[model samples]
Target: MFKKVPILIFFFLIFFVSFEDLYSKDEYFLTLRNEKVNLRQGPSFDYPVKILYKKKFLPVLIQDSSDNFRKIRDHENNSGWVHISQLSKKKAAIVIEEELILFGKSTIFSNPVALLKQGRLVKINKCKIEWCKVKTGKYKGWVSKNGLWGLL
Candidate 1:
């Protein structure tokens, strides 16, 4: 029985570590799953609707969770509870800077593709060390990661 003690402790440690990882807040970012989602005052549908979000793919920061709902904060600093089904793991970001220049290449010296104003939302294709490839409407280019929100 003494030999089995070490094995039991190893399994317990693994299970505890996995549980911590599953519940860590760690700046979880998610996007709107549908074009229309209601931000409620509480975690349940019985609560009053605080806001009606109309933009799909809008990035939100997950702050807390209760049952099937998650408390999220938008780029505008608006906070409310939303159903988990209305959120998606798909990566997206909002331009936080006043005027962010989208470059043809990741390097700043590259030709400018477009100028993105603050509050502009774009889908993230991929990210490098200091830049991210993004797409918004007809514009597709690389922007510095510093100018974006919703990234860890």
Candidate 2:
């Protein structure tokens, strides 16, 4: 009976901790699933649309969540509410500089693959300390972490 009581207590503690973590209001990264998503001034559709995001896979920082909407900040530092269904868990990033050189390798001295324009949305494959591997269409390369948004 004593051993069983200790095991039950351990299981309860683990469950409670996991549940709290699931509901915590922590900031997270999300990508736009659709090519065209509307950012509104408020959580509901009744609010006026403030911005139109035309690029799919654009990463946004989720600041808060309402019943069916999420308050998000884009790479351009614009804050608006978007429908939750428009967001996806798939990782992605947006180029923040006027232009960025994608390197075949992680370093600048390495071969340049392409010149990516600002606001280009790319799927994030992985990230290191100073660079992240991204892909858009047929191009896949690494961009400096300094010029990207949504690397956390």
Question: TM-scores across all candidates?
Answer: 0.85, 0.77
What TM-score does prediction 1 earn?
0.85
For candidate 2, list the clashing residue pairs, or say none: none
Candidate 1 lDDT by residue in tens digits, 1-152: 99999999999999999988877765689999999999999999999999999999999999988899999999999999999999999999999999999999999999999999999999999999999999999999999999999898
Expressed as tens digits, the lDDT of each residue in 111-133 for candidate 2 is 99999998787888889999999
Maximum-TM-score candidate: 1
Worst 10 residues of 2 by lDDT: 19-28
Clashing pairs in model 1, backbone N/Cα/C closer than 3 A: none
lDDT of 2: 0.91
Q: After superposition, how far is residue 120 of candidate 1 from its true place, in Å?
A: 0.6
Q: Which residues of candidate 1, in runs, are more than 4 Å off?
A: 1-22
Angstrom error at residue 25, model 1? 3.2
